[model samples]
Target: MAETEESTGPPATLIDPIEMSKLDTKFREEIHSMPNGEELSACFACSTCTAACPIANIWKYKPHQLIRMILLGMRDEVLSSDEIWLCLTCFQCQERCPQKVRVTDIFFDCKNLAAEEGKVPPNIVGLGKELLEKGQLYTVTADWEREDMGLEPDVPGLSVDGLRNILKETRTSKLVDGDK
Candidate 1:
């Protein structure tokens, strides 16, 4: 006779509980070591940070989720999320956070972690390259804007080469390389 249903006690698991616990402990220690991460522990989950973030409206995962993920030591999820890249760095959320959590700085930290792991999105990498090479993110002509304003076009306008050289000197060019 063939047996039916109810055989396994529980499904097999890939994650090791002990390893996960260790990682959580390490992450908490690292967060506490940061200049302002102690503020992270004060979050009351009011979600005001998310509400104040302009980019949060369009994000698949909002700021609050990122904070929760950090608290839970979900490193892979936080590092690989597109929401971190989408942050405008406007500091609106940080300004509005009742807990005084440095949301913008945390996003910067997450972005740096993702970049170190080579997980940055291709489009963003490309834009960084363009900015590095051209010394400008947009092609809007200053003269054209001046003309629209009914003002005399300024002479000795922005020099792309000079800007590019400055960026190179500042070592910002490395930010463009996708392989980095």
Candidate 2:
């Protein structure tokens, strides 16, 4: 007797039916009006963006799936989704999209909207705080990193104090401080 071979892939997921009442009908239009979001309608659900994404395998919803969700006006789900925060802003998906949908930029627009609503992840907010306070994301502990690149050991005196002062008056500082 021949035994059936076990499938190596993850189990199939059961998709829940979308409720018409929950969908924000104007959501797609809102995204469409944003810069670089106008071409969202061009996506034909080819999954090319998903194929081009380096981290697609780990995504809760792949690139094409996100576009479909936007087109379907899944406002609450899309806005509250942790998936948007997971994006790396790499242009591979955008570059490979036959529709030229500017996938990365569109995601950025979604991120902005989410940020406006204070849906940002804590890690990102912490990074923003670091940037606002230090004027640089990475620590400048040693000069070897610069020396390895054939550059001067010390970063020339451009006062981060002035930068922090100026940034305190900007929107970024408020976002970092959770002011809005």
Candidate 3:
């Protein structure tokens, strides 16, 4: 009979029970109340979402782990984490979720809440500024590219004034302007 080799490393560390009273119980409830966030509790941490995510390799908190954190009521951690904004909104995780957890939608809600708290990343803030100022995220395409593609060089006009009015009426206006 072959004998098993003795362990060379330190003894296994044991985990103590989490103190339930210390958990932020309201955080999960608040998330559940948001639109498309009602199904957050259905996540079982199967890691399927993480496996399906194309950019999970770059994420500090994987999709499954983000859901787990939200379920665990780590509100400040989740809201402040750049991982929430790192999502590409591709909906791959949402499509792959066995429980249909709407992972991308939940991230959108988290982002909105984070933006309200002035926790958004600088690049995102820049994008918001551009949208509010120009009514578009990108500048008009180059004339050479349009001609190469057999398209008109000049695109139709946009309602910049209307867009500005809409932006001014929305919470995003305050967020973009740093009015908090």
- Count of backbone collisions within predicted model 1: 0
1 versus 2: better lDDT goes to? 2
What stretches of model 1 exceed 4 Å from their correct place?
A: 1-24, 142-145, 148-155, 160-162, 169-171
TM-score of 3: 0.82
Q: List lDDT for all candidates, in order.
A: 0.77, 0.84, 0.84
Report the C-alpha lDDT of model 2 over 102-162, residue by residue, as the tens digit: 8988888898898898888888888888888787787566477788888776667756777
Q: What order do you get sorting by TM-score, best first?
A: 3, 2, 1
Better of 1 and 3 by TM-score: 3
Pairs in steric clash, model 2: none
| lDDT at 73, model 2 | 94
Alpha-carbon runs more than 4 Å astray in model 2: 1-16, 143-153
Provide the lowest-lDDT 10-residue window in model 3. 1-10
Q: In model 3, which runs have C-alpha deviations exceeding 4 angstroms?
A: 1-22, 149-152
Question: Lowest summed lDDT over 10 consecutive residues: which window, candidate 1?
Answer: 1-10
